[model samples]
Target: MGSVLGDLLPLAVGVAISPIPIIGAILMLLGKHARTTSIGFAIGWLGGIVIATTIFVLVGGAFGDSDSTVGAWIKLVLGVLLLAEGIREWRARGGEHSTPKWMAAIDEMKPLTALGLGFALAAINPKNLMMCIAAGVTIGAAALSAGSNIVLVIVFALLAATTVVIPVVAYQIAAQRLRDPLDRLKVWLEANNKTVMATLILVIGIVLIGKGISGLA
Candidate 1:
């Protein structure tokens, strides 16, 4: 179990450092329903990854063996998609852009609506979707007991949810002092979001392609 968790740590880290969620959480923290909204968002974010990974694992098991070749091919295609996205983000990083329109209205949203938004971002956003799928593929292909497999999936979801969880908790504990630092982080992430995402995606893509080839071999 520990070994499997160790192997999936990179994916967890990638998901944890996801900028949009961090930024969105920050925005929610500064809103009227800061605590409730942020907490709901965090729950939805965690739930999204958990639900998506669970479905992938169950579907993968139903379709074929754990180490099936189809899984390898799926990884290969996803790897290529990641690489393309990386290149696109790299090229677009240099352009001047306005803040996303959705962000402007975030402060006005109720907690329940914020929860749905959080789920959508984590579950359906292209970059995040790729990472979750990659993790699912890895888990689905590994040789492990069913119990261990589910445990690792839980760990993945928890680790991936760490970043968003921190700010929400800290705000609940010490909003005044934490505000400056959190705001600084939000500003920095917003400024370098594309560059950070491009680099991480490219590195992960290369690794996935190598893993896929090795699996196919």
Candidate 2:
């Protein structure tokens, strides 16, 4: 169990990034429709974790345990970057940009389309992938971690889904109960999205950095 936990902990932490209020806010603001937004969010979150883990595996596989140390350092770097991103979000002011064109088109997509969109996002997101891979290396248990296939997949999926699923529920509920307010809130979110994004980024970054550094030292 302890070994299982060691393998799972980092991925869980990475997944937890989604439910973060500021991060949630940013995700909400990113898409025109809830489905697309959620898909994008989930994809982004899942991808980051997967990439992180993959990177760790590659490095560790090629150079042996040295990759673990590098992974620790990488984690610290990611943490710092997130912190900076958060600060930018928290401080951002005025109208900056609209949802990217691709996202807007996605708003009209069906659920399966949304799901596919999300899957792709998760598959490709560099940060998400790198973060997960880095976390794996940090665990330092290639064989033990590798052996628990079912458990690891479940943990990864659930944890990653949490970031996407929670927000979708909240957004739907809010849209239903507070229609006008929801509209207003969405507008407000769009207007000040950067500040909120920066704030979340900063928080995530700081936490990652702290954890990474602690692990490294």
Candidate 3:
């Protein structure tokens, strides 16, 4: 269990530190309907992570056997994909960085729209989706008891959702104080999103590759 959790930590952190979702959360918190929209976004973000990771966990479990080779190969393939994505981000870092059109409209979004956007970012976005799948595969490949798997999934989801949840919850408690800070944060995130993601994804990719190689050996 400890080893499995160890393997999952980086993957969960990868999801948690995704700049786009954090930026979205911050934007929603600073919007007119801050409270409701941010809360709805948080729920959707959390649910998306949970659902995506859970589905992959079941898939991994279904393929589990008396061998570790299959799991290691999957990790290696995912690592390569992530690595390629990281390179792409790094190369594109110098390109024109503009506020996404969708983000420009965030201030006017309803709670439901915010919710859907949050879900799409967490579950459907390629980078985050890869990390969730990796985490799920780690948990499922461990062949732990059912109860243990559930606990691990919950832990991973909560950890991954922490960044998105914190600002929303904090804003609810201290709206006036948080607004400026959140706005500033959103700006910074937008500016540095590519560089940050590139560095983070590259490291995670290397780590996954190492783990996969070690497991296979």
Candidate 4:
């Protein structure tokens, strides 16, 4: 179990350092309904990760071969997907630069809307989906006890959502002092988002590809 969690840590951190979601949460914290809406978003974000990863884990368990071939193949396909997305983002970084349009909508969002957006970003975003798939396959391939697997999934989800939760808590504690720092952080994240994501995704993709090929051999 320690080995499994160790292996999953980088991917979990990948999700944690996701600039867009972190920036989005920060923006929500700056809004009028900061506490209520940010809490909703955090819960939805955590639930999205847990639910998506759990589904993949279960599906993999049901259909995966005893030899772990299915897990290896899934990793191969997801790796290729990540590599392609990394290349796309890398190319886009050179073009006309602007803040993501969605950031503009954050202030106007209600708690329910924020919840749905959080779920969509965590569950459907290509980078996050790939990470979840990799984590799910890693855990499923290990054939750990059901109880251990559930705990690991929950832990992974919580770790991934930490970036979102922390800012909300900080704002609740010292909303005045945090406002400036959080705003500056949001600006920097928006500015360098592409380069950061592209680099991380490319590295993870290459690693996953190597792991997949090694497993097959």
Candidate 5:
């Protein structure tokens, strides 16, 4: 169990390390929008990974072999889901005029809009979902039975959240600190929102496509 926990920490660290620079920049530049968007990404990443991984780790390991052919079907379904997500996000690349999913609907947003936005972004992401499946498969195949290992999976998820959320918190703090000078910057972000949204969508799409293809391999 200690060894498994050790392995999980490093993977979480690796994922956190990947987007700290780019995503961090986006947060700092985009300000409040970045706060909401990053939260969305984390929600999507955690929700998809944890739930999907839980399903496999628990059910697959208990009822059948972890190495069963069912994994291919799982991967295939995950791939398709991610592909659709990539396309959806891609379509939302431009400004709000181009797509409704670009950012929080400023006009329609209520108190819980931020939370809803977070769930939607995370849930719609296919690549993150597939990644979770891969992680679950790895854990299930090597570790104790799913019934016994459920807590470990949950713990790994907490660690994963910590990894992703740290940078977001840092970015938000920095953004808040810059509020004076960046108040004007918000106007710029609003005017240039299309550029910011497009870039994120493109990067996300490329990542998903690559991962989906790897799953096919």
Candidate 6:
């Protein structure tokens, strides 16, 4: 269980620090319907992470043993894809950073819509989805007991949703006090999004590759 958690920590952090979702949460908090929208978004985000990771863990479990060659190959492939994505992000770092069309509509979004958006970003977004899949594969392949799997999934989901949850909860506690800071954070995240993602993905990709190699050996 400890080793499994070790493998999952970086992947959870990868999902946690995703700038776009964090930015979206900030936008929701700063919007007129801050409380409902942010809460909905947080719930959706947590649910998405849990669902996606759980599904992948099941898939990984179906692949036979934890240390199977097939699992190692899957990790290797995922690592390569992540590495490629990181390089692409690095190359595009200086490109114009525009507000996504969806973000522009945040102020007008209903609670349900906010929930769906949060889910989509966490489950459907390629980068986040990849990390979740990797984490799932790690957990699933570990062949842990059912209780252990549940615990790991919960841990992963919480860690992944922490960034989105914090802003929402904090705003609920002290709405006015968080306004300026959230805005500043949103701006910094927007500006440095590419660089941060590039660095993060590259490091995780390398780690996955190493793990895959070691497992195969």
CA lDDT of every candidate: 0.83, 0.53, 0.90, 0.84, 0.49, 0.91
Looking at candidate 2, the ten consecutive residues that score lowest on lDDT are 18-27
- Prediction 1 TM-score vs. true: 0.94
Q: What is the Å distance of residue 122 in model 3 from its true position?
A: 0.9
The TM-score leader among the candidates is 6
lDDT of 3 by residue, 1-217 (tens): 9989998899989999999999888888877889999998999999999999999888788767676788898899899999999999999997897777878898899999889988999899999999999999888888889999999999999999999998889988999998888888877887889999999999999999998898789
In model 4, residue pairs whose N, Cα or C atoms come closer than 3 Å (at least 3 residues apart or on different chains), thus clashing, are none
Task: List where candidate 6 sits over 4 angstroms from the true fold.
Answer: none
Question: Could you give candidate 2's per-residue lDDT for residues 94-182 as a string of tens digits?
Answer: 54665455454654555555555555445555434444554454443333345454355446656756645555656655655534554
Tens-place lDDT digits, model 6, residues 121-182: 99999999999999998888888888999999999999989999988988889999999999
Best-first order by lDDT: 6, 3, 4, 1, 2, 5
User: Which stretches in model 2 have alpha-carbon errors above 4 Å?
Assistant: 1-67, 91-95, 110-113, 126-130, 139-143, 166-192
Worst 10 residues of 3 by lDDT: 59-68
The model with the greater lDDT, 1 or 3, is: 3
TM-score of each prediction: 0.94, 0.58, 0.97, 0.94, 0.48, 0.97
How much does each candidate deviate from the true structure in C-alpha RMSD?
1.5, 5.6, 1.0, 1.5, 7.4, 1.1
* Superior by lDDT: candidate 1 or candidate 4: 4
* Native-referenced Cα lDDT, model 5: 0.49
Clashes of 4: 0
- TM-score for candidate 5, please give it: 0.48
User: Which candidate's lDDT is highest?
Assistant: 6
TM-score of candidate 6 on Cα atoms, chains taken together: 0.97
